[model samples]
Target: MGTKFGSVIHRADRGTFRAKYTYHGEVITKTFKDRLSAEAWLNGERSRVEADKAGITKWTSPTDRKRQEAAVKRRRTLFCDYVMDEFAPTWLNYATDGSELASGSKRKHREYLQHLTHSFFWKYPLTSITTEDINRWLADLDNFGGATPRKKTFQLLKAVYSKAVAEGAVAKSPVTMKAPAVPKSRQAQIPPATAEELQTIYANMPSTTRISVWLGAILDLRIGEVVSLQVQDWNPKTQTLRVCHSADVNGQLKSTKTATSNTTQPVPPQLGKLIDKACEDKRPTDFIVTCADGTHITPNRLRDHFNEAKTKARRPDLHFHTLRATSITAAVATGASLKDTMQWGRHADAATSIERYQRASGTERMREIANGIEDTLMGHEPTREELEAEIQKTKERLADLERQLDALK
Candidate 1:
């Protein structure tokens, strides 16, 4: 009773069965201990050959299948390789909005990528990384210190995976963690420099660089914008200072931080005169503020001088940006509307001007408010001088209203 199975022969002399299959002009043979085992082996080989013919499988031979798998493994992208080789190179070229990132922003992304390389799963294949791996990496970021850095690193990592997903490298990202909260230290507002503090700092600054303080505290220009001011960017006739460019961390000239940051600010008479003096005997392309060698001053150098001046003024807490805060706060104190203050500060929105720059009312403003309340309660009569001032203000208001009505007509 010889077993009858395709390509399976009962070798009675050897007490075994031989199973053979031909695939792509190659033969595969295996010996089984019994007829049942041989039949099963032959059936599997036949099914595999059918699958190959139907284009369901790429290889029929086991060695060829192993080779195909090895080739696929070579094509897998690792996390570190994708970041360093592909993403980092083009990150600064365009932002999410398709605009070139500011140099400072580009620099920060480079730093974030550097930090990501330190993660434990940097060597893992992009598709193989799991949510548990991301969470673990975030836990390790705690040792790197500060919530801000951790948050930024996590965001960069998410962006990397997002790029991978967009390119069809993976079905989805594994970065499932919510964005880290802002640190409490950053949430607390630092007070703007008071009038007395501003004056003291101004007096302490060297005469040559005193205009930098005015630029910050009066025009509300950022440190980068201050250093990037050229003679052509100022208009003496209109008393307007245009902010079109700013210095990056490396002191390289780049566009302003945001589109709204490129604004023309109306300069006060005092600051305008100071600027005129700074621009004396200089070309239209010369920097408004320069070092002793007549070259544009770097932000670091300006900060060094500013730190010395603030220290001497007994306001070590006053950062360079505190001067900008002082300017916006002063504008608001002068009864400037929210929209006006937003334009004056060159902020993108009213909320940023109010929440980030404006500070609580100072002692003088508080006293003025209290005095007005007291006068109203006591029914204080207006003196002759006060009455004259009120009449003048009323006349001006009526004239302005008439002009607006005429324009409407």
Candidate 2:
């Protein structure tokens, strides 16, 4: 006779016991010589099933378990293969912050990945790469170029290891060191162009592209935004310009840099007229700035023209982006509040308007402040001309007060 205990079955004719179980629609069966062995195997299998159900393990069947183990081993054994073949492609699709990577950012990240190929541990397993290995690789970046490139490379590597950790490919990131800092000398702020210098640069630009200079200097638009403008973005009736998109280096139109950058700004009447003139015979879809052949003007093309214009104006140090700083500084000089300046520049915060765009006080404004300080602190007597001017100002105030009193009566 045959006896059965749970999923363990005894066959009398074969004098053997079989442990059999089904999990996730897959059958698992094994033969044992004795009943005790069959019972033991059955208990262990059931425990594995429970663990899998509880999310403690992924044990489904022996074949699936082997496949998962092999995949983990391959991820550990072939690090560069995992990175270049698997991780980089996936990581490039989405940024580390979980947003879709922009085209320009994707291109830059691809370049950064190339630097990792030159590392000594490029072929090492993910688990085998230690913090010391990452340090050595960073130290070797100097041979490739300057600190800026090295810093970017280090950041990319750190992001890679972080992805590996999240995927369970590595227990922890090996890139434990802080990022390398580029020297301050290389990060000095370029001074904004003066109003006179801006005029000279604009005058030197080609007639077809001169509007770009005004767009940048007056609207505080980025080069990308200037090149991305379309005929429809301008409202002649409302005298407003909409900034909703920017062009990448490849001249592909994309969303603006930030949510706040997509806004409707009041355009100066003069600039609005220029835009109306530019759109005279063009359709709404036509680009506002175009080359001679009527093709859309790319940022690179605008930049090349701007470079020539600046060179001719004797301001080779002036970049097209300096126009934005000039516009923000001009707004501040008009006694505009910080909030107004930030809105004019389309910046996210007032601190950026103050620290980055606004320049130091002009020579005349500083002189006025210095004179006022002397008068207040030194107790200097007013000159006869100043006293006479004060008396005339008082008479004007008395006249205004009397007029207001008569109106109230």
Candidate 3:
């Protein structure tokens, strides 16, 4: 039986006091160690019991001594209760926006958290989680595959721990305790097409799909942007295609992948004409590119059909992202510098696109310059007979100019 009186003596833990009473139906006896706190609580209980005042606030536990023992046992045997239960929601959302993860990155985070709970992190109090534990997780993650997943797993760990730090659930994240050394996976950017190859590709597809993907790769629009292109999004007067909206799985309005994604992409004259054709005789709400069923084309379906075009063109390596890669290549070839490529790609990150995607070594650059010079000089070189023909043509042009000048006089 629990003690009816609420008197409590302060324990060695200082703040905790031991008291026994019926609190809310449970006979919870734990430490309620503070003197003033114990007295206030006891008076409240006495008022409720003696005066029959049902409105008095109830104490946390019916038996305070037993609760204190249970708490001590938990602390001695358990390592898991570091982060408070209430702090999880904010931390999950933190992984999405604050971390700058890839699309659907939350799914990966859930996996990491689920794994950590089953691993040693489950028992280690969030405050007590050490650098060794994080490194151990990294070691186990590295055994799975190459650099990409290892980096992904490391990032997930950082996010979850960082959240605990922010919520005051831990003194500091073990993530910050040690630097993790991870090898970078250099994603081999697909090479862009020469003008001739593009002409070949553009020739194969119907005007609508060909130009749409081509413009997308050039603009570096997110896959969602490709599907949401509308007739009104094109402004021929400005020779620009606006990216005003993006689609979800259900083809509804959603915020673009990032703020940078909502941008205007300059449409070349050739692509502008294709947009016009797709929009020809269509309503304002009509789409630019559609499926066989006349619904807007999704990114997955676009990539599938784009592959067929690549196959027919005898270039099997090309993919949808390749189009954007090729566009940056073309911009570079046209003397659009690396900084220009970043702008076109809408990379909010300040690094030049050449660093991220394009790699033009000094040797390759000199070769390109040599080839350009050779092509220019070779195209206009004059042979002996051709020189004589040019002399005659020049005399005729001079004579024509003289005639025009005299006629004007």
Q: Per-residue lDDT for 95 in model 3?
A: 38
RMSD of each: 12.4, 10.1, 12.0
Give the range where candidate 1 is weakest over 10 consecutive residues by summed lDDT.
355-364
Q: Which candidate is the best by TM-score?
A: 2
TM-score: the better of candidates 1 and 3 = 1
**What TM-score goes with each of the models?**
0.63, 0.65, 0.62
Q: Write the per-residue lDDT of candidate 2 for residues 292-326, one digit (tens) a residue.
A: 67888889999998999898778888788888877
Clashing residue pairs in candidate 2 are none
**Candidate 3 TM-score versus the reference:** 0.62
lDDT of 1 by residue, 15-48 (tens): 8888876677888778889978878877777777
Error of 1 at 401 (Å): 30
Local distance difference test values of all predictions, in order: 0.79, 0.79, 0.63
